[model samples]
Target: MATSTAAARREEARLAYDAFLEECPTGQLLARISDKWVGLIVSALGQAEDRSLRYSDLGRKIPGVSQKMLTQTLRSLERDGLVTRTVTPTVPVRVDYRLTDLGSSLGGLLSSVKLWAESHFDEVSAHRDTFDRATATS
Candidate 1:
């Protein structure tokens, strides 16, 4: 009885996930993953041979990222179980961030997207300029 009830609940929850829906929970996830800082942070950590980086190292690697934004981004990643935050006990204490298995899976896909964007920057900029000029005339 209890087993069947739990299964039913699980099925119901699964049915509720729909990324195309305006109010779906997955929409929030999309927004989180699509954030600029999130992409940069994930890319930085993902490219590491060890897939780990300290907070300070991440700050240095990603330019223009505010301390508060980094803190927030890391917290969100940790909360979503995408990254693992480890702390070491020491005189000053040490903290490190690394990709979990799930994060690692996303790393390759996001890395590809980053590469594509970098490779196409000039072409995209020209298109944007053309669009802007055409729109300005209208």
Candidate 2:
């Protein structure tokens, strides 16, 4: 009786997840993963040879990221269970981050998107310029 109720609730929750609906869990997840910092961090970690990098290394890799923003983004990723944080007791307590299984899946998708942007930026810019010029004349 109790087991069936729990199963029914789980099914209801599964059915309620619609990414297009802002109130859905999937919608919230999409919003979280779509953050610029999150995408960059995931991409950096995914490209690592060992799939892990020290906090300082990440800071160096991501340009223009203030210390506060980096720290906050890392905390949010950890909370989302997409990245794992490991600490080693060394001279200064070395801390490293690696993407979890979920993060790896997301990273692959985001990485491809990044590559696509790099490959097509010129075309996109040209199209934008054409649109702006045409609109200016209208």
Candidate 3:
């Protein structure tokens, strides 16, 4: 009886996990886009006249991003079909980043978030300062 109960519990857990994955097939995709650098990169691409940028240009445009993180984020975005990477056959190997239709669809949502953050940043900062001071006093 004890063994059977344990097996049932394990099966239940497995089903739950599988269901979660099914519902959130792009959970990791969302996570990648939520990253600071990823958001910056996506926003930059969205704003670009051509809607694309060279890898080196992206690295320079986005402040405080390391080469490794940018590379990883770009690869993940490409794999998730949100971003497309194009390579030009050249001596130094030129590469560019562009958004897919899916990524473009996210542009308005991200822009709204950006607008909210910018508009309320001062208020949020003040609240944080007050909270910090109160916590320190307590």
Candidate 4:
């Protein structure tokens, strides 16, 4: 009976989250996951069969990411429990990163978002051009 009661309380706690509320932590979570770099990094890590890559490899795979930015992003993801960083002792230290189970679950969602952006780029660009022209005339 005590076990059942605890389980019920846990379920209730899980159900209490509401992203729409101003104080809800889920809003912060949404912001982190929706970030462009976060999405790209998650997708890149997800693509690897081992779901892991060295810091240099990640930097190479993701063009235009500054070393500082990549380091910051990886640290953030690690803090959020989405990725794990492993350091190997070698002649030169090696560091590798991999997505956590939670992060792996987000792969498909991020991939879909990437595909949508790519597929709709032209349409979005046309709209932006039209808007810019109208704003200029006004």
Error in Å for residue 55 of model 4: 0.0
Better of 1 and 3 by lDDT: 1
Error of 3 at 19 (Å): 10
Pick by TM-score: which candidate is best? 2
| Candidate 4 global CA lDDT score | 0.91
Once fitted onto the true fold, the runs of candidate 1 whose alpha carbons sit more than 4 angstroms away are 1-15
TM-score of each: 0.86, 0.87, 0.77, 0.83
Which order, best to worst by TM-score? Answer: 2, 1, 4, 3
Best by lDDT: 2
Q: How much does candidate 4 score in TM-score? A: 0.83
Q: Give one digit per residue, the lDDT tens place, for model 3 in 10-114.
A: 986677556247565355566666888778877878888999999999999888999999999889878878799999999999999999998888766776677
Model 4 per-residue lDDT at 27: 82
Weakest 10 consecutive residues of candidate 4 by summed lDDT: 1-10
Q: For candidate 4, write residues 26-65 as lDDT tens digits.
A: 8889999998789999999999877799999999999999
Alpha-carbon lDDT, every model = 0.92, 0.92, 0.83, 0.91
User: 100-136, model 1: which lDDT tens digit per residue?
Assistant: 9988887788888999999999999999999999999
By summed lDDT, the worst window of 10 consecutive residues in model 2 runs over 1-10
Query: What's the alpha carbon RMSD for model 2?
Result: 3.2
Clashing pairs in 3: none
TM-score of 2: 0.87
1-138: candidate 2 lDDT, tens digit per residue: 345688898987777996776678888888888888888999999999999999999999999888899999999999999899999999999999999998899999999988998999999999999999999999
Model 4 spans with C-alpha error above 4 angstroms: 1-16
- Poorest lDDT segment (10 consecutive residues) of candidate 1: 1-10
Q: Which is better, 1 or 2, measured by lDDT?
A: 2
